[model samples]
Target chain A: MAKMTLEELRKLREEKQEALEKRSIEGKDCRIIIGMGTCGIAAGAKETLSTFLSVLDEEKIKHVAITQTGCMGLCYVEPTVEVILPDMPPVIYGKVDADVARKIVKEHILGKRLVTDHMFDRPAADIIKQDGGR
Target chain B: MHIAITDYVLEVVQNAFEANSTETRVVLQETAEAFAVTVTDNGKGMSEEVMKRVLDPFSTEEGKHPHRKVGLGLSFLNQATELAGGELTLRSEVGVGTTVRFTFDPASIDTPPLGDVVSTFMTLLAHPKAGSLVIERKTETDGYALDRKELIGVLGDLEMSGNLHLLKEYIASQEAALS
Candidate 1:
């Protein structure tokens, strides 16, 4: 049996309302996706995602939807992250740790500049070929 | 809600969070005879009637989940512990808070594994709503605790996940040293 008091319900409602307001704002077209599959988890992807969340919160950065996904078949670079900005190509970055994640948010997302060093360089055709080959 | 492993301790932790408690504390202990866990939260506690039905897998207050009929967290935990020759206890005061304690016979064949505790703590600590979490694990010889407040003071609010790799290593070393 599970039970919640009226007060608890009210608290939950407030939390949900705050979350909705945080998410449903206008002009929030930037999306950050962190790979959290088994390989990614083993490689510390969760920590990378956490770094992004804290940094965004500390900076009061809004309108960015943060989420997690499964493996991208790039096991060599386990902690992969994809950033999609409105009207820009989706950028995938590999080997993203806490420090690198901060740079992604600061330089790429906010500064409107890509961090070229950590960018995933494999061509789409090559990735497709590898997948099809598998 | 759908846990692949039967360790049910994670659900207890989640419930403490759902209680909208201002503070939450978790303690895990392992001894020669049994393994024990207790979660305490400074949230709105349940009524006597409600607490009595807490294990009634189907018993839940109205307006919790509009889509689901049963509230199974506590109920399932009760069943799991009992099957493992264990006991689950809850103590609460309406305006104060709630505390749940569960113990399992370590030697029992039906006992469930503790599961991936580092992941559990990481997930819980990552939630923005989780104001503060105190997790302490102990065996006979030694124990270590991670307090969010102390961590923030030391690490400058780097985010739980940001520091999780180091945290995992610290926990592993502490456990290893617990001989």
Candidate 2:
């Protein structure tokens, strides 16, 4: 099979940009970040990240930007992920495998409803504060 | 997640970075008949016992990942490599880090697509722990290599979404030029 072509990439970028514009016009922006720290990767964060990317692409839901970060000091929450919606606090979800990641994309990201069951109880700011602003 | 071979390569790179590697080198070589990828890292390598257990589909270190009961990356890659009539090799040392190399017959019926490597590289560039990354792609006709430092100098910080897009364009253009 051939590698992805430049044209395909251009189209992908265009689609994503259009999605972003559409969201911005509605006055909102969203970002999804997956933790890829050692524990995270060991727990399958790589696959989780891949799952989110593929899900977002398959759904053609472009308003959200997908990114990755190191361990959030939540080792027990290997494969931890954070979702930030427009004007809302960042919600961190733990034990996120492929299925959980898909749900986060479909429900939390596109549907605008938080998945309370899997979310970390404390908000991101509180966690940062406890860590002394690392 | 279902994806192409290149995405799996990116997963391996992520694993290397997670190990706190000071440097990671990825080499992808493609010929008319075969495709090969190798990732080497300079981080804390695994012990022999750990390395032996890493290949088992049922064995993953506890506390490493929250919910996963197994580590399937190597096992899955091994299956794919063998399905393509190729082999997977892993070498490691206690403090020297690890190297994972695999090859596949591109013409094999079971071989998967190469996927979007440009995006994979861009994603790696965005990782904060990615100290140094060198990706080289080669074919019988041409080849090109990208260094992280050079990329940062040419396109600015990859953490920014705008720069990530620019970096992807740059890589895609370069790969196109190679072909």
Candidate 3:
């Protein structure tokens, strides 16, 4: 791969700006989630995020935004994943291997039905406090 | 330690390879004050702009390959080194190569606890043909070097799965002596 110049990087960012901006969940009925935490990366969360992006691209799914955040405090069950749907309860899933991630895309994301077993059923209030009010 | 040094080394080296490196050299030295590691690679180096943003925990460069998203590995390395009361310096020249240096204070509160070095070595040795990973551990008394190719020649055609168990045990003992 060739080294990317500042101008080239800026151009690329610009090219993707529309898609990225369109996917933000601020006022749209979109889903947003991030994998934050140290253990997540060690467990291949980077790869998981890439897989999500690829799947979303292939499926041509708009109105969904996927981004990364800092560690969510769970280490053991790394490669952790979270899912949020507009007007729906947010779901946190742990120990998310690639297979489960695909399922999340095929079922929870596209089918609009949560995968019962993998969902973290903690109270939203507790999760909010744990996330420092985010 | 929160993030094992050996694992950190492996992850960084892999990142070097992903940057399209042809040759990679790693040096680990323990001085009276700290343990230092330097990884140099002959890969497509980063530009000043990229370097400026590279250290940010959130910066990522989209690549043709979906998995080529940036910052995850490098950011982790940066955080781990800092948590260890260590410092990480990255220097790269476009079309040239890149070098990363890490210095860790052995007696700092944030210094990560060392773990099983052998497991670290075993995982690295498993990827012999990918690139060269040279690990040199220098102590006041003496030091040792583990070259991936040498390990492969010794194991010869043995299945990676079958050999992993035995190799893990052997490396553990060697790391014990080094520690």
Candidate maximizing DockQ: 1
Q: List the residue pairs that clash in candidate 2.
A: A43-B65
What does candidate 3's lDDT look like per residue over A25-132, in tens digits? 555555545565677888889788777777787888776767677777666667777787654567778777778888898988888888877776443585475442
User: How would you encode candidate 1's per-residue C-alpha lDDT over B1-179 as one tens digit per residue?
Assistant: 43423247677777777778868898998898889898999888999998998888877767777877788888877777788888999999997889999888889888877777666766666556567888888888877786766654443333533245444544455555555
Model 2 interface DockQ: 0.04
Tens digits of per-residue lDDT for model 1 on A42-131? 999989977987888888888787777898778788799988776556778999999999999999888989899999943366544433
Estimate TM-scores for all models.
0.59, 0.58, 0.51
The reply for model 3, stretches above 4 Å from the true place, is: A1-134, B64-70
lDDT at residue A125 of model 2 (Cα atoms): 57
Which is the better candidate, 1 or 3, if ranked by lDDT? 1
**lDDT score of residue B12 within candidate 1:** 78
CAPRI grade, predicted model 3: incorrect
Give the top-scoring candidate (TM-score): 1
Q: By lDDT, who's the top model here? A: 2
Error of 2 at B55 (Å): 1.2
Worst lDDT run of 10 residues, candidate 1 chain B, spans B154-163
- Write the number of the candidate with greater lDDT, choosing between 1 and 2: 2
